[model samples]
Target: MEPLDWNKHYDLANLPKFDMTLCWNCKAPATKVCSGCKETRYCTSECQKAHWKKHKAHCKMFGQMHMMGELPKIMKKNEPKYKGPSMGRCSGCNVRFTPNYPPNDKCPECGYTACESCVVHEVRGTCHCTNHNFGRTYCIMEPRWYHKNGKTGEPYIGDRHPEDPLHEYTPDMYEPVERQCNNCKKITKVFKKEYWNPQRFNTSWF
Candidate 1:
């Protein structure tokens, strides 16, 4: 999708010049444009093939886009909204739950309904044991949320198990704990907060 403020760009939009003297696949300018995409000009088919290794993924799906002048879909941001409940029903063939009992199916009956495409999970609790797994893990508390926005860059209260992908946020997962340095032969770890404030290692002023 277009960036947030795309309407403002309509007047300023500039189509790239498909300069047909260089390689179109690489945008290096092409001696001949491919009759297929017409957007690329390759010095030789060999140049196109060499570039294909990196370009194939985008090439197949992008072929029609290049010719038809349409942009690809943009990815949604990662973090989920922390709303209270399902306001509507599930689009994924969900049935309504009776008021007496909680909806105990793949889909839920209450809280704000999301576009099925947008919904990651129907249940609200963090820690993956959504449906009362015997372990019944604790809800990853917000304070512990990724070590309070620690440098690890894991989301707050991500899934707890180190094996779980979100485990990266758990302070204990990566531990930032001491490790034997392969180079120095001394124990090493991430610099402590005393020495590593974001302003020093992060924001800068020239």
Candidate 2:
């Protein structure tokens, strides 16, 4: 997604006060609310620029609302809701299923149903998750092995072992698995001891 041009929507007098008191940019006391969205705040221009990448989508939506002169109405409509399960295909695997499927959970923002496997994969960083707000999906990085003698202090280029053709490597040999978030598409390094949660974590996603 592209960054929003906030300069086009800078009208402080027309902007509303954000419900939160803290700045979304620096978590400091905010003195200004984003004139474009009126939903985000920043302590200064530098902070706003730093947070623009994460806030652009919401900012653009609000800008659209301002253009239509329906900011209030649209904000109310976009409010989060507890949407019980509805019949639909899994957002992750695109498999069709009923609401009663044991592995389904509906998105509160978009009413999209994600199957258990897909949700597991998302949280575990094995695959991508659908973003209802953006009408698109984000993906996690794939796992890779590093070479022993290749360039040091630089990106790793995979090295082949003599047994590559005769033996299979298992992930169990590694300590802490590296996974990525589907929402932010950022890598998360997790240790088995600290991140393991039987209720929410599933190895099947790997």
Candidate 3:
């Protein structure tokens, strides 16, 4: 059998630049590449030794790939953008499933989609609105819906009057306020300032 040309498999462009890459052990600029893998770089032998336990499995895998005459294929093919009606890997646990598995919740901040199991068990929390006379405790998960000012698009913290069906609330009266976590009862204080306003109002609950 012809020997496999492993040299062709190494994608050097995909490897992180050695000068900019930091040592896994010390977070310092790496000065030397691992002799076995030629991938992970370290500043000193001490850092390499300190990182050995964590690097051993990766080292072995690289060694196996080298022996197999396969250049490291680290660049993954870009996955097609997810449309509705299909399943994908859960960002939380890295498990891939089909529609049999429940729908995933996408994070507004990072755009990571986690499975329903993770959302329910790991993400769901109770938030308390102290402005309410009874102090309303409500269950909240990722992608929370909030009432934002129509003109400024900034979220307002004031409670809407129950009898005011027309929603006659003024912007000045909607001052920002601290809200508590109903489960832990921890208060998070924020300045009454608008950082980035949402362009569109959230109509999911409406």
For each of the candidates, the C-alpha root-mean-square deviation to the true structure, in angstroms, is 18.6, 17.7, 16.6
Per-residue lDDT of candidate 2, residues 111-142 (tens digit): 55567776545332122212221132221112
Q: Arrange candidates, best lDDT first.
A: 2, 3, 1
Q: Write the per-residue lDDT of candidate 3 for residues 66-173, one digit (tens) a residue.
A: 555543343233545433222377655667867788545653322445576755542221111222211222222112233332123343343232223544334443
Judging by lDDT, tell me the better candidate of 1 and 3.
3
Q: If both were scored by lDDT, which would come out higher, candidate 1 or candidate 2?
A: 2
What digit string (tens of lDDT, one per residue) describes model 1 on residues 8-109? 433325633344566645656467555555555587788878766555444544466564553432223344544334444432334344465333332221
* Candidate 3 Cα deviation (angstroms), residue 206: 84
Model 2, backbone clash pairs (residues 3+ apart or across chains), number: 1
Which candidate achieves the best lDDT against the true structure? 2
lDDT by candidate, in order shown: 0.37, 0.48, 0.46
List residue ranges in candidate 3 displaced over 4 A: 1-20, 65-206
Please give the RMSD of candidate 2 to the true structure: 17.7
Report the CA-based lDDT of candidate 2 relative to the real structure: 0.48
> What are the models' TM-scores?
0.22, 0.23, 0.24
lDDT of 2 at 177: 50
